[model samples]
Target: MTKRDNASQSKQFSIYLRSTNEWIPVTKEQYKEHSKFYGSFRKKKQDHCKCTCPHQKWWFCNADCETCKYRTGGDTVSFDFMYFNAETAGITPLEFLESNVNDFTIDVDNKLISIEIIHYIQDVAPFILSVASMRLKGLTDTEIAKKLGMPRTTLLARVNKTADLIREKFPDYNV
Candidate 1:
């Protein structure tokens, strides 16, 4: 390949620099240098949670430490580390399902929906409840419309109507 072709190809292999908050193209040599720098920096920055857990030997807190009922709040760790550690631990499907339930209200962007409001929606407009449930499960408008056998526009209209109903009935909700 020509030099220009090689440069373009190298552009496809890019690495993100967290410190710089940028994704930069890397040639093989540059990639090796960056990898070495990152690896050494990571090694130098190695830290362990200072929690009182007996199994605090790990570099980072593990699932066992997190789940231990006796765990007192220790040194606050970065959110990224906690998220990755949780991913490594792996939650059961039952745990995932149970976590979604809230006793009273579902809060989204400061808007609250109480259990009574949910029951009101079920009694007055059952379809709205279904749409809301599907939306909560991370379904897009198009996907929900397809599943409900309705047009995209109709789905949008229903969503708006549901919002309007909530606002009208529970003005304090600010939906």
Candidate 2:
């Protein structure tokens, strides 16, 4: 698929929490961990009728117009694009994760562990210092993982943990 298609491969989670009556924007990772899922619902096959369909943008025919029934005096077709977990919907995944005392969060909580994670990023700073360094030099994540003799999964976890540390350290900085 194209770049746009690849971009859309990732899903966004927008939550309307019933208890708080608030809209919470969550990250993609959060969506994966704490929710039932659905989607990648690209519109396919149009109708052949002459009636105008709202899904024309998806290139459907007139017969496919039923799918866009709002134009046909029907109430708009409300699709559950993603899984609706009435139970989970009332609470956010991040809040759920935070409630559980997971290893990742606990590691992040300890000052020594936090410093170690921060150091990993900082230690790599010089390696990333040059303007062209990011573009030109050295190992990719996979390569670095191999060189450091760590599993790719471990490396990724470390990197993710480091990034979380940065965010926690400077919430208002918008890193």
Best by TM-score: 1
Q: Supply every candidate's count of residue pairs whose N, Cα or C atoms clash at under 3 angstroms.
A: 0, 10
What value does the lDDT take at residue 47 in candidate 2?
31
Which regions in candidate 1 have their CA more than 4 angstroms from the true location? 1-113
lDDT of the candidates, in the order given: 0.62, 0.50
Model 1 scores worst on lDDT over the 10 consecutive residues at: 53-62
How many Å off is the CA of 111 in candidate 2? 25
- lDDT minimum window of 10 residues, candidate 2: 37-46
Candidate 1, residues 1-175, lDDT tens digits: the string is 8999988665655566444557778787877776676444333333433344333422222233445443554455433342325454755545544566552235552344577687778877788878878989999989999999999999898778877887888886555
Score every model by TM-score. Answer: 0.35, 0.25
Tell me the TM-score of model 2.
Answer: 0.25
For every candidate in turn, the CA RMSD to the true structure comes to 21.5, 25.3
